[model samples]
Each structure stands twice: as C-alpha cells, then as structure tokens.
Target: MRNTSDISISVVVSCTAQTAALLPWTLKAVMAQTSPSHDIIVVENSAVPELPSMPAREARRLRLLHLPGAARPALRNAGLAAAQGVLVAFCDSGDLWKPSYLAIMREMWRVEPRLLLAYGDAVPLQGDTWGTERGFANAPTGFWDGQRSLGPLLSVFDQPPMPRLLEFQPFLPSGLVAQRGFLERVGGWDTACTLLPGHDFATALRLARHALFGIMQRAMVGVRPEADGPAHAQAVNMGEARILERALARDETLWSQAQVIRAAIVRRRQAALAIAFARGDLAAVQEIAALLPQQERSSPTLLKLGLAALPAPLRRAGSAALFGLGASRTSLRWPGN
Candidate 1:
C-alpha cells in the first residue's frame, strides 16, 4: 500500500444556526482524527454567519466560509469549490467522526486507487446517547450481500444495479468521502435541488452511475437526529418522490421499471397526503392527491378522498381518531394507504 502520509484530505462541514451549537463537538472530532486533514472548512448557511471560538492552534488549519441564507446544496458546493485537497470528506454540523475515520479512509484509497466514492456506517446519536443500530442496518435486506469484499472491513459495489439504489437509498453524506476530481466530474452537488430532504441521495444516484463505489463496514461516524414532526415527514416524502421522478426522466435503464417507480412515487405522495390531512392542511392534501395516479382506485385512495371532501373540522377529528395523532401520523398504517 502507498504511504498514508502522501494522501491529503479536506473536511467540509455544513452548518446552520439551528445546528451551530453542536459545531464545537464536530470540530473536536475532526481535529482529533488520527490522520489529520489538510484543512477543515465549515460553511455556515444561515441569516447570520457566526461560529464558536477555537484556540489559535486549532483555528490555524480551520477556515470558515460564510454563505448566509444559502441552501444545503449550495453550501456544500461552495466548500467543494474552495477545497484544496486530493480527497474531500463531508460532515454535518452535529455529526462526528471517530479518531481512526480519516486513517481508515486514507488506507482504503491507498489500497484501491480506483475508488471514486466511499462511505462508512454512522451510529445515530440521540441527545448525548448513542443508538445501538448503525446506519447500514437501515439498508434493504440483501443489499450489501452482493458487494465484492476488498478486505474484511471494505466492500466494493461493482457496477451496482440502478434499480436497487433507487428502491432504497442507503448512502448518507455525513459518512461519505470522495476524490476531488471525481466529485468535480460529477458536477459536485446539484444546486438546483435546494431545500430537498434527499438531495444528497439524489447526488449519490448521479455519482453511482459511473463512479467506483465502496463501503466501509465499520461505523466510523456519528449522526445526530433531525427535527421530528409530521411536517418534516411530509417534506421528506415529497422530496423522495421528486428524486424518483428526476431519476426516471434521465435514466433510460430505469424505464423498464417505470411502473414500479411510479408506484413508489405514488406511495410517497400518499404518505405526504396523509400527513397533510392529519395536520389539517387541506390545501396540501388536495394538491398531493391530485398528483397521484387517477387509476389508483384502491380503498385507501377512496377513503382519503372521501375524508378530504368532508368539513375541515370533521376531517381533522376523523384523521386523528383513525391514524392516532402521535408517532403514527408520519406514515399510514395500511400498505399503499
């Protein structure tokens, strides 16, 4: 293997006002890496560009790019443009990296010079507590089983099927590291996809088309939980549907599975509609319902439509009683509902 010292890495962190408080912990993790990065860039996208103070020694290699009020994709793109390393890694404001994270990634790149994109598993952090499940556990069954092992801890997806990626996206930006040249070749982040929940997933889909992808089986990153609520769920569903639509439009390979993709899109919209209905957002409910296929005469579709037609107050009450206005409001119970 090539010398690890020869590999240069830049870490890009995306932050907003809401997540700025956790930035110190994130910076601490980055600074503590066994294989230190060439530089650390934090892109602050908020109304006011501000960051917590750091010691002179720690701040020397750290730079702040203040893109006030910019969207996530734009923030990341800005960081990518300013990065001056051979490999670029991304982290969210509240996420963390284990001390060995960069060392492991550098070793993997040294061993496999063809790797364009690689990601590892991240353990979810809820407040100060860590979750037992790693991020890869969320991947669909048998998804990783087909990968060819580069080593005991490394697996490469040799020409992964596009359908599988579309079906269940398992990539997270926080866990990803990519070659700077390959990232630029793929056009970096899609600035057009601003404010979308799964823009990173969408970008990964684009990269997966031609890049050599790899997975580190070990969990080397920590992911903090995002806001939880029905509105958040609704936005996620809508964003996912949009991503599927864009993929179907551009990729002819997915044309064969148009029906499957369409069905998936409808399922997402239906979930969004359900959330809208539960939250008493009648306008959103009707708007989302209109996008669903007219041929969907399923009982759930009929029931949702019928409920949507009733008086606003009655509809809200009925939705709460049926779906239980708690955690279940995020998704419908019945399949295809």
Candidate 2:
C-alpha cells in the first residue's frame, strides 16, 4: 500500500444520460482540487454516443469509460476497478466539491492511516425541504461524535463501530473518501444495489462494521437537487428500505437499531406522499403511495390520501397551507412533495 506521502487520488465521477449536462461542472470541481497528484475517471453509463469535451487540465487527468447503458452501481464498480490512485473518491455529476475537500480528507487519512473511509456533510443546492441536506446538518448526531480540527468540524467513528451506529446515513458518495485497499478488502459497491436509495449508505455501513471511518460535520460538498428531485426521492425511499431489510435479515441483532431507521424511512415515505398530494399531483401521490407496503402505511399517509382526493385547486391550496403554516409545527417531509 502506498503512504500518504505518495498520495495519489483517483476521483470517480459517474454520469448518466440524464446527468450529461452536469458533467462539466463535476469535472471542473475535480480540476480545482487542492491535492497536486490525482486523476479522474468518468464512467458514462448511458447510450449517448459521445461526451462533451473537457478542459485541457481535466482532459489530461481524465480517462473516459463509456459503458453505454450500464447500471449506476455497475458504473461505480467499473470506476473502482479502473482507478489506479492510492486513495479513491466518488461524486456524481452536478455536485460541487469544496476546493479543500480532497485536502482535508487526505489529512484525515494521514492522521489515521488505517481509515477505511472518510466522509462529511453536504449542503443542498436546491430549496431546503424536509429531510434535505440542510435538515441533516441541524439534526443531532446519533451515531457519529464530532471532533475539532483545524480545517473543518471533524468526527471519528472507531473501527467496528458500536452496533447499529450507522442507522442514520449521514454521508453521500460525493462526501466520502476511502483507501483503495480497504475498499478492495470489503468488496466494492454492491452491483445488486443498482438503485442508490441506500447503496452508498449500505456500502459505508458494511465498511464501518470492519474498518475505521471519519466524518466532517461542516458541509464539504454541494449536492444539486435533481431536475425531478421529488421523483428521485421516491427511488431513494425504496432503495433505503430494501437495503435496511437485507441488512436486518443478515444480522437480527441489529433489529433494535434497524427499527429506528425503518420507522424513519416509513415516515419519510408518508411525508413524501403528503407533499405529492398537497401539490395536487394525484398521479405522483398514487405512484409513491403504491410503492409503500400496505402494512407500513401510517395515519399521516391516510390523511395525505384523503387530502389528495380533494379537488386539484383545493389540494394545491391545502398543500401550501400545510407546508407553510405547518413548517414549524409539522415535521416537514422529504423534498418535492
């Protein structure tokens, strides 16, 4: 394994047909990294024939992999295999990284050479909605404990973290940096987790089970909300649920911790359904609602369903009222209704 002195980072920016427009910005951020020696691999998982040309510096550092119709997780796995750097980092198209992101994470790895992963908070570029990155910043730290650092607010979750310590996913792929060797040892991203809802979280959780990790409280990355952010939320909701269910099944001891997370996911779904109903998007409401298991539906979901059944005009007005008046009183749900 290479030492931090010989630090060379391989940043994997995964792009898709829908995310093509954001690729330039993502690559630009990579060019601005404070670290001196690093390369980038863009795994384009789309049927698009060609990618936009990159700037000279980024072009020099980049190796384009055209998978032409590949799953997200598979794209990541491909990037993982192709990466040659001692340390590896990942971010999606459209997300912007702070200039110091790589520098700080590298410092953390320098401090603890055995670290399997280092991740931090991200600021939401879109509107601050329920369960958004902005909200996560305000939420209390349950699994991760904060630490003081010269650059950012840092935290360290010891290797083999306390059971269920990863119940709440506090990080994203954009915010994480990991050692290549450690990742290889644990096996790369689960290709089966073709859906993200929790692929990033599940991978991190599984790594946390065996390796040391770090976290930064301050936002190190700025994640842009998708064009159809609400629609993406539904996918994420399903993704998280599936990941948790599989995890729980594998280790029943995590049931207590998993239950808290399970309830949270359910509530998020209910909140999303409410938002959809309020926005007068009956179709979206129905679609999101159908995704939830019948047994998991809660009172809030029932209320949202009733609200959605109202006339479109009334539903829109009620949604605005619920979101506006209930801002402080009601627990705001996920983004985009």
Candidate 3:
C-alpha cells in the first residue's frame, strides 16, 4: 500500500465474457478521467478471457488480471488484493463514469483528509431511454443539490439529532472512491455476500461505522440496466432485506436510523411486487411477499395480486391503468416532468 499522503487512485473493474460488448465503452470512460489513474486493473471473471483489445493510451494504464472460473464478488476481492495505490475505486464493465468522477473524488479527499469515501449521483439508462435510479430520484435536496454545507466532511453519525435519512438508494461500487487503508481495514468485500448479492451494502455499513462519508453534487456514472429477469426477483429483494437485518443485528447504535432505511426498502419492495403481479409472475410475487411485513402486503397490493391471475390481456390492461407501465422504473419521480 502507498503512503496516506499519496492521492493516486487504482480502479478495479469487474469484467466477464458476458459483458464483452460493454467493456470497451467503460474503459474509454476511465481513460477520460480528468485525474489520471495510477492503474486500472480489470479482473476477468470467466473460464475464458474475452475482453477486446485496449487502445494504446488505455492499455498503458490498464492491466488485465484473470481469475478464470471465479464468481463476480470473488473477482472483485481478487482485484482488491492486487491493488497497489493509496486510493481505490470500483467500476463494472458496463457502467460509465463521467470524466470528472476521479477529479471530484480527489478534490473531496484533499479538502477532508478524514473522509473515508466519496460518492456521486448516477443517471441510469434503461435500453434507449434515460432513467433515474433510486439514489438520484429520492435524494435529500440539501445534500445532492449542494445547498447544505458539508464543511470539511459529512457523516450521518457525526451529529447529535441525525439528519432525517431519505428513502434513497445507497451508493453502489461503480460510483465510489475510498482510501486504500480504509478499504483494507474493512476486510474488503464480504465474499459470502455473493449468495445474498448485497456485498456493497454490507461493506458500506462497515465503513459508516468508523469513518466519514462525502456526497458529491453531480451525477458521476451512467448505470447500465440490469439484465436479470423476474426469475431472480426473490433473491434481489431478499438480499436487500438481509443486509439490513444483518446490520441491525450487529450495530445497536444504528437501530433507529436503520429502521427508516428498512421502511424505505419495504416501500420499494412493495412497488416491485406490483410490477411482478402485473406480469403475472406469481412465483416471484409469492417469494417477495413472504419477505415483507404483513401490513406491507396491503389490501391494494393483494388486490393487484388477484388481478394478475386473470387472463394475460386483462392483466396487462389492468396493470397499465393501475400502475402505469412507464412509471414502474421511475415511480419515485411520477406525477409531472
């Protein structure tokens, strides 16, 4: 590891054969960073390497580290182990970072040496259209909008009457940059979370306990749409709930704060169940429903569940009227423009 004074960053990118088509764009975006990188380590997680050739400029900063036949979380763990810079950032093959991402992170760390990590908003992309992800959509106006003064650093645990945490999405790995020491001290990603799929959340919770967090005002990445279909809905919802459960079990100080977060997640899960019911995905609906509290499985939600059992055409028409197809992904932003 480099000295704490060293500000250079090493970026770990998770890649696989399935994402070959998207890797080039991601790499190009990394090379465009206003703050030049110390290294860009691409961790290939597949039986056979399938990444395309890198351009001369990017190839100079980029190196491929193969962990053939490894899982996604394992690939990230391997890359973290191989990192050599003072600061580390993560990006997935399909996520595109804005040119100013590393530059802003560098500035934030410089302004506050005590800050353990910094993250920015992301404008999500769904197929050909632009979409807003949970973090950006429900972000507390003062923080992300830059009205509140973060001063040197910001920590949810720093003040006495904590800020009313919003029902917003937590920052994902793709948009985060953290101190190398902090990352290592947290024991890197939870390898066991591969089954639960909330490794990022678990890691963030660990970091929040001991260090400060910074929130940048600009959107830093364009999140690629997820490809996993309804078949994995149960796992995804359950994974989020499990992460919160584990956090509450481990930290009593955060109990009150985490309850707000838990409520927000339940709301999102309820919304998700609506989508599943609209599609007549009974199995997914059943699995996800079992994870929520009885009150969350409301009369309206249950009514929708019954409607979904109707004929396909009837269900589609009912769902469109009740849920609005376009509103599903951006429900938090509904009503007007």
Task: Give the TM-score of each candidate.
Answer: 0.85, 0.73, 0.73
Model 1, 1-337: lDDT tens per residue? 6788998999999987777889989899999998999999999876336557878887888888988788767888889989999999999888888899999999888888788889888777877676667767677677677777778789787774455665566667788899999899889987766667656667766777764688898988888756556677687778878988988898798788899888878877877887876676767877887888888645665676777788878987766666554236464320011
Candidate 3 local Cα displacement, residue 105, angstroms: 1.5
Which residues of candidate 2, in runs, are more than 4 Å off?
1-4, 47-60, 126-136, 141-143, 146-152, 159-167, 195-199, 227-235, 250-337
Structural RMSD, model 3 = 5.5
For all candidates, the clash counts are 0, 0, 0
Positional deviation of residue 34's Cα in model 3 after best superposition, in angstroms: 2.6
Model 1 scores a C-alpha lDDT of: 0.78
- The TM-score obtained by model 2 is 0.73
Instruction: List pairs with backbone clashes in candidate 3.
Output: none
Q: Give Cα distance to truth, residue 273, candidate 3, Å.
A: 3.2
